[model samples]
Target: MSTVKQLIPHDQALLVTGSLNAMEDDRGHDDRSLIHPVQIVLDGDVINCSCFDSLGELGVSALVVVQKDPLVTYITTGADLIELSIENDGSAQVRRIEIPALKDVHEMSLLDGVLWLANTGYDEAVAIDLDEKCVVKRIVLGKFRGKIRASLPSFTGNDIQAVDRYHCNQVFQDINGKLCALVHHTSGKQLLKRIARKVIKSQGDGGVVDLDTGQAVSLSLKGPHSVRCVNGDYWVCDSGSRMLNVYDATWRLKNRLPTHGWGRGADFSKHHGLYYVGISAERKRYRDRPDYNDRNLIEVFKTDDGELLGEIPIVDGIEQINNVYLLQRGVVETLLGLKLSSWV
Candidate 1:
């Protein structure tokens, strides 16, 4: 039995898909290695294998995973894909596709056969075709607020302020289909003052920018990572400083929950009628490449009173996961382990 597990509500029980990976260098050898790319699915009552083969390294760096009908895509920093073909027997084969123009694609989404990706290194968003593995369109938010693509978040739960920092944050889509964007600006004096608080500064603009109209708006936060759409509202998680900021669908910061306990990725849990955030290590800093197998675990908390709920300890030395979308249905487990040609 796996000791590592996630916590679910009373109506929604916990399930272990065991869809995961092995730390390539389990022995703590001098040489850094990689285990075959792996993933898993944990349905309410069933846990099955995934249909993916190509462990495109991009998905790991971006910290992204999403399953669309008939397809599952992983986007890493290299802006690549670990494509798979789902078979009748629930097995999968991997297909490699490289995406250009993305310096570093962090997060991705699939809607209406279109793959929406955020370029973490660049201030842009790209949509691609899964079948053809080609670029369809691109949205370049030149100098949008500070690395607009660090970690794009997608919300399937209630509006509990999922994230607060630039990374692992989400973008919202309103009724008109226009994207909610951060309008940004900066003052050298103001920035220098904020530096005292250890604020993560953006290379793009100093403030938030509008997505469609490209307007500048005043936003407040210690740090804002990802944005998620929940029940016609938006949840913002600022993991850098451990705060959850709320926003209306119109892109206004409305409510805030201080780091009552811990939260990396937060969402409103319908089953419990409260907001929940998946908490993990704040972020690790290695002095001289510290040992990998020391301590790596994850936790959960309530967004309402900031109560500690559960803990998940993974063996892969993964310490930077903010949220996990646990649905009533199981995972998109069409893909299996890969038969790689050679990862480069």
Candidate 2:
């Protein structure tokens, strides 16, 4: 049996994004089905699950809590965006915005009121003006063949051909306040050509790039997913290597911690003085050994010493976790509006 430690404070909760698992048996079921993408709130032993019923058949990738007073959250589901607002009484309201240009959208970062989305399929980072609800800018990356436009007057999902050249998965604000993107496979276009010829297998060719200058900031990574700046240090989830890499302000690797599974989502909780890293079960194509049922878990580590504290299994029909965010429990409670029941 798995035991959970009471590391999280009572005042805070973790808002987690569980990506859709198409491998599950109940793929085409209704909204109540657990195989679809979901937003989960973890408060100590209690777990609150929320599924988007209005938005049908979309995979929830990443989300950001833009406001806390009314508990407003923006979630990325494939090419669509969901605006979720929670009232004081705990009722939830959802607004879906369709952006056809975005494909395989992943992590997002908010800077100066603009939301930067990693449009993975198109190998671009798209900037959306929240108030205006329009695509303000698009930063093309990694051997994209499509024509670059200075500005998009309207959302055209079909204007550009979708290709996952770089597999650009995450976009976040660096310590210097500049936007940076984590490309899962930096040389993805070359790798795709090699794959067509059946010559070589995909290897670790991932790196981080500064969106402003369109230059690589960090290199020699394997399937990098998320990046966060904590106390002047950059933490990256080197997923393909199943390692948590820490880099100094100069982008020098300071430490590397081995996570048993494929490391993906990551966040630091200042209130708890710890770091939470999400790991998913290794895919069959990448695994050298048999799969482990208990591989999908969250690894908690001490911030100061990088000590492995404990592991929290993500069960209850959640097959994979994409992102993790630590927020106030009061806010989540208000947003969920659910009575505390039993431990997960």
Candidate 3:
């Protein structure tokens, strides 16, 4: 068994989000009763788990730590954005905001108080105002009449159509402070062709697109998930190929580190010179496959040399890891606050 000390410092903790295997529905539909919403915290040798049953089966996907002073965290389900506020006195509050027309929200980032979400189901990226708690802009990624719209005017759920052509799963801010997307398909033309043929497949040809420039900065990726800019370098999770691809400041390929599983959620700890990457089990589509029971874990790597340091196994009931975030032990203890006793 791998120990947490091998993965991170004793004063650091990791926040993980995923689906519980036993609570998942066999049919793949979002059944509220079958969904178990929980937050898993790995601190020291203790695994702290908290269940938010009141969230009503929204199904957790991606999350971001938006604030540190008050310790605020935002989580996304397909249908809602849940905000968690932790007070210094060890009390926490939860708020759920309804976001219509959001489908398969995979990853999100916060910039200038606006939360940007990769709305995968609708083939668009959405910007939600943190203060107003509402969507402020929608950047359409799919082709309408063979052309991609710069932005959609509609805001309601029923106003737009669901195409999911590009499978835009992760949204982040580049090193130059530009908003970008990690799409599962290479180009708009390829996506349109697949839609026309009714054959949707995730090939190892996805790329990163600059939302502002309307151009692809990097290409030829396999099922990419998380993209993080660290000290001017771009580190991407090439999940489809089970590798972590690093790029220089010029977006040139620098290194490819093997993750040994389906790479998805990831975060970096500059304080420790390490990278925490989530390696999840293959999805339910591969239920009968030989690797279906593969171990789910967080692989730690040395950022300086791209060395595989160690891994922290995700045990208990969680089967799928959607995101992994590193936090200081002080902030984590404050977030858990009064709830730590009941959770641990």
Best candidate according to TM-score: 2
Candidate 2 residue lDDT tens string, 255-275 = 998887878788888656789
Model 3 regions more than 4 Å off: 20-46, 53-58, 143-164, 189-200, 284-293, 338-344
Candidates in descending TM-score order: 2, 3, 1
Q: Which model scores highest in lDDT?
A: 3
Count of clashing residue pairs in every prediction = 41, 2, 0
Please give the CA lDDT of all the candidate structures. Answer: 0.43, 0.67, 0.71
lDDT of 1: 0.43
Model 1 Cα displacement at 47 (Å)? Answer: 10
TM-score for each of the candidates: 0.61, 0.81, 0.81
Candidate 3 lDDT tens digits, 1-344: 34676677777788776664433443344545543444445544535444443342444677778888788888776556788878766577777777888777888888777899999888788999988989899988753323333221222322233334577887777777778788876455333223443433435557777776667643577678888887679898888788999999788999999877889889998877899898977656567866454677888888899988788877644557788888778766665443522211
Score candidate 3 by TM-score against the native.
Answer: 0.81
Q: TM-score winner between 2 and 3, please give it.
A: 2
